[model samples]
Target: MVKTTGFRVLWPACSLALCLLMLTGCPGPGDRMRFDETAQVSQQGDNVCFNITDARDYQPANMGINPRSTPSKEKNFNFSPGLTVADGKLCIPPSFYHFPDKGQFIIEYLLISKEYDEPRSFVITLEINGGHIYNVTPTEREISLPYCRYVMDNSVGTCQL
Candidate 1:
């Protein structure tokens, strides 16, 4: 007769779960996004637009934008080709949905236009006053440009430079 201990059964299951988690690279609370200080943000017509200036070396791929009131809720808008580059800047049309006095959005893209690489993502938290962008604030410490740049360029396993 074979006896299976509870520990033995749980160990295999736990190991498999951990392997799956690593392989998927699932983002958790600790996952932090890199900020783009070089991005030029503005209100164009009824929409908000973005472009990366000074850093001509980086191009975006698989670029998309999501406007939201909170992390889990995605707001809808009517726009074809959600993101576009005009005169060297990435831009998006205004959402038909009504926005609050302030708005928050996320832009995700692959830096250097590398389709296979993990996308660089950031949150743009803004406060609108008198129909203009009054403030662009960092949501957290890690998403600040200086800190993110250090991590991306100096992290032992992530960057060779």
Candidate 2:
């Protein structure tokens, strides 16, 4: 026969509470996440990483990492600004508007994405401190993604969780 003390009985409950706290500490459904990344034109060697503080088991999707060249230049031109390293450190230039010998190279864009429900809008807003820059309304999105989440073939949008 063994005598069990109160420590044994409370240990499980304390463990459970700790686990729950850890799990809920991060963003769950219907939370906004911010990504600090350098905006660039090309996908190759691009380092536009999107991440949230203390997050796992989730990812970003359908971000319009795409920007078209202004009509003035040839179809294939790298006018948009990209994050570059200067003095052995990451540097984001003052503007995304750039062209060879040309003043400000502007890219006119209207962003859109498939409605995601978990987010209620798949809401992703890109805010550039200097330069300027979604679709899927907050209301329409909340109801859409959850309905199509398990459909296998997602037409509205895509997300990994």
Candidate 3:
């Protein structure tokens, strides 16, 4: 009887340890957002241009402003943002403005998904310079991209989870 009880306790502990180890070694969701495209912006006397095609293409679901926070008890699992969905992608435009004095900006992208009765929240940050851009994942780790900056300002407001 004592041996059986000890086995039961040890089994749970072993399972938990294995789960933690797997999570630590696996890449996170933010790591998946790192695209392999040139994100550089060229400026010609105040004219700036950059292509967001790669980023837009692999944009993970719920990675936008006003994502669906509540799950519906009825109907198919259709999600809706507070505003209209544009081209099947929720558009959360950058509100961060880089003034001459402001060298850095922290943009936040809140991701919320409903499962059963609870909602999950994930936050992503983007660091931007005049011609440089970096992506910060939900883990708060900084990832430097070649030429893309996420503009996060007051205009990029928060949504409740």
lDDT per residue for candidate 2 within 36-58, as digits (tens), equals 22222211122222222222222
Judged by lDDT, which candidate is best?
Answer: 1
Q: Higher-TM-score candidate among 1 and 3?
A: 1
Give the root-mean-square deviation of each candidate in angstroms. Answer: 8.8, 16.9, 13.7
Judging by lDDT, tell me the better candidate of 1 and 3: 1
C-alpha TM-scores of all predictions: 0.44, 0.19, 0.25
Give the candidate order by descending TM-score: 1, 3, 2
Residue 154 C-alpha lDDT in model 2: 20
| Candidate lDDT values, in order | 0.49, 0.31, 0.35
Clashes of each: 0, 3, 2
Candidates by lDDT, descending order:
1, 3, 2
lDDT of 2 at 111: 19
What are the clashing pairs of model 3?
39-147, 133-148
lDDT (tens digit, per residue) of candidate 1 on 1-161: 13568778888999999999999898876576644442446777777666554334345445444553445344332224345455766655554333455555544444454434443443444456657663244444414454332322111112123
Give candidate 3 misplaced runs (Cα > 4 Å).
1-88, 94-104, 109-116, 137-161
Give the C-alpha miss distance for residue 107 in model 1, angstroms.
5.1
C-alpha lDDT of residue 71 in model 2: 37
Any idea what lDDT model 1 has?
0.49
